[model samples]
Target: MIGEFAKRQGVKKVYGIVSDYQVGRDMWASLKADMESKGIAIAGIDFTPIGTKDYAILLDKAMKSGADGLALIVVGGDTVTSLKQGGDVGLASKMKVMGTMLMDETQGQSVGAGGALGVHSTLRYHFTQDTPRNKRFVAAYRAKYGELPSQYAGEAYDGMSWWLDVVESTGVWDKEKWVDAFRNSVRNDSVEGAKRMRACDNQAEQVGLFGTAVAGGAGQPPVTMKVTETFTAQDLFKPCQ
Candidate 1:
């Protein structure tokens, strides 16, 4: 999705940080191809060994690479490391920084309220989404879990319910058949209300609310986004080739 977004924005030179995982390496290779096909330049590529404690050197390399944007694929401790390193080196203000699911609401806090401001990332759902099905899902989730559901939890519930719907519709539990059904289904209704969910990728296709980390409110935690605009998934994701 980040690659697609960069392509759409006509980004010419892209840089990214990845860990020593196979997925990270594969993603970088794939995006490199995609960008090349689109005539974009990959200005820099940096790989940090997994579980590395210090990122100052890697972050400095990324900053000096003259990239128009940066994508961070490292998660957990590394996500925080990348963010802090970017801020300390003044790269956060110099480049457009985006991240994967690992950089969700929880990790955003660890980067500090001010340090994480204006950083962009994607998610399947947010509690503040205004759809009706989402409202019900939120209410029921809170009723059951005593709080809001994270993106992962919401997607898990939705995936199960979606599978059930497919099973009942087809009267078969064959894995291939169910997969086909899910691929063909169009979810215009969310557990909260009428928010759109894309069946093709099993991802919510509704507009994403752009949020910025702010100081935690009186009973709230340290990191929260002040949603700026709602962007559609169609705008972010391209059809599979």
Candidate 2:
């Protein structure tokens, strides 16, 4: 979906910057495949060690690469620093900024709305999903925690909710039985909407949300993602083997 967004924005080439780690490598690979498959070019790629602060050189390289966008595949604190540096260097004016999990509500808040604004990203969940169940979840969560929940928070809550349901239905506490049940379970009321566990990979098959960072509106946080596209589980995940 990020690739689709890039194509929609006429981004023909991109420079990839990712954390030097297994997860970061995986994310970069996926983005690379997606963008290339859409006929977009990967102009160049670089991996930075986790916790490395200065992104001036990297941001400069991306700008010099003649790419139309920066494919950022960093997470956590790295995301905050690199995004701030990207803004500091005025990279957004030179190239579109986007990639997987690049900007979420917390990171957007940390980077400030102006820094995160217009940056594109994709993830499994966002607090601003306009479903009744998600609306309820966000309201209750904010009422208790005094802020919006992140993707991790939503996943944890959904996992626990599904687990308790399976436990109650099976009338057993055996881990083996729970694992088996989990492989075949589905949650219709998940905060991110309905999803089912794929028996083959034991992965949750759910919606993929694509959005750009924008102001959170009146009485809201400084920033929030405005979902621009939604890919169904069937459209995203491959068939179970």
Candidate 3:
């Protein structure tokens, strides 16, 4: 989706940050291949070694690389650190920024006020989405966890629950049968607002919310986004042909 968005926007070059970890390296390679196949060029690639505490220098290199956009794929503590430093260096204003599913409200707060505002990325769900399944999921999650669930938690919960449901219903771990059943399942009953899960990619497709970072209420922390619109999976994703 990121590649398609960049391509559609006439961006000739894309920049990305990857961690030195195995998974991060692998994902970066995949994204590079995808972008190249679409005729987009990778302007620059920066790999920050794992456990690197200071990102000021790294951000400097990335910003000076002359790329038009930035995609941050690192997660958890590393993501927070990068956002803080990225904001400090005015990277967001200088370049279009997008993040992975891990860029949540908590991380947005660290980016400071208006840091990630208007930054667009794909997601499985958002707290502001309205749906019966979502309502039930939210209610149940708060009831169980004593707090509101983020998209990550909701997606994880839904994926695991769906898998469990299939396993229990079929009473066997037949991988092929489970795979087929999952592909054909129209799981409108998701707590994460997913309409269905694609067994082929093992990814759930659903309406995604786009949001901008905004100041939280008085005396509250910064928020990641103010809901802009509900985008269908098909709308956000362009089929590769």
Candidate 4:
């Protein structure tokens, strides 16, 4: 999603800042592959140790890289710190910034709408998803928990719901039977939209959502996510190897 969006935005070059770890290394590699496949130059890449608060040097390096896009591939508290400091240095303003999991409801609230505005990322589930099912899910979640659901919470609910449905409908109590049922299930009514289990790899194939942080409208929360584009499962998922 980040690579495609960057290409559309006419970004010919990009710089990346990622965590110095296995997951972050994999993410950086994926981003690099995607961008290079689209003919975008990788001006520079930096891997910062997790929990590194000061981004003066890294941010300065990115600024001087002559890149039109920045890929941020950090998570957890690192996400908050990098984004806050990135804002201070006007990085987002200077380049098109893309994140792996940036500015969701929790992070957006922490960064505030001002800091998160215009930042884009690919999301599987977001509270701002506008649909009757998602609206009900969000409302029920907020009513019960006093807060919106994140992607983690949403996936848990969906997975649990599928399990129960399979058990009830098939009257299967065997663990293997349950697993098989799940492997064959197709959930068209998920809060995040339609998804189906790819039995070959047991991977869930679902729609991909590209979202951006935008200030809330009237009666909305201080920070809200706006889905700018939606990718079909076919457009997103790779074939099972």
Give the per-residue Cα lDDT of candidate 2 at 65: 95
Q: After superposition, how far is residue 152 of candidate 1 from its true place, in Å?
A: 1.4
Best by TM-score: 4
List model 1 lDDT by residue over 1-241, tens digit each.
5665566656668787888789889988887887778777888888878777888887777668888777777867877777776667666577767666644466666787555765666665567777677788879988997866776777677667766876678787688897777667656666533334456556545555444455556545566655444566565566644
* lDDT pick, better of 3 and 4: 4
CA-lDDT, candidates in order: 0.68, 0.84, 0.68, 0.82
The C-alpha local distance difference test score for the whole of candidate 3 amounts to: 0.68
Supply the TM-score for candidate 1.
0.76
Candidate 3: residue pairs that collide: 212-225
Candidate 1 deviant stretches above 4 angstroms: 7-12, 36-40, 170-183, 191-221, 226-241
lDDT of 3 at 75: 64
After the best TM-score superposition of candidate 3, give how far the Cα of residue 235 lies from its true spot, in angstroms: 5.9
Name the Cα RMSD for model 1.
3.8
Candidate 2, residues 1-241, lDDT tens digits: the string is 7777787778899999999999989878887998899999999999999998998899899999989889888877888888888877676777889878888777787898656887888866877777777898889999999988887788687788888898888888798998898899998888888889999999999888888888888766677888888888886788987
Instruction: Report the lDDT tens digits of candidate 4 across residue range 1-241.
Output: 7887787778999999999999999988988999899999999999999989898788889989998888988878888888888888777788888887777666788986556877888776777766677889888998998866886687688778877887777786688888888899898777777779999999889878778888878755677778887878887778887
Each candidate's number of clashing pairs is 8, 0, 1, 0
Tens-place lDDT per residue, model 3, 1-241, is 6665556556667788888789988888888898788887887888887666888877776678787777677766787777777767677777767655635665566655544554655565665567777788878877897766776776787778887787677677798888777776766667645567565665666666545456666433456556544556896554433
For model 2, what is the error of residue 200's alpha carbon versus the real structure, in angstroms, after optimal superposition?
0.2
Q: How accurate is candidate 1 locally (lDDT)?
A: 0.68
RMSD of 4: 1.9
Sorted by lDDT (best first), the order is 2, 4, 3, 1
**lDDT measured at residue 5 in model 3 versus the true structure, 0 to 100:** 58
List all candidate RMSDs to the true structure.
3.8, 1.9, 3.9, 1.9
Tell me each candidate's TM-score.
0.76, 0.90, 0.75, 0.91
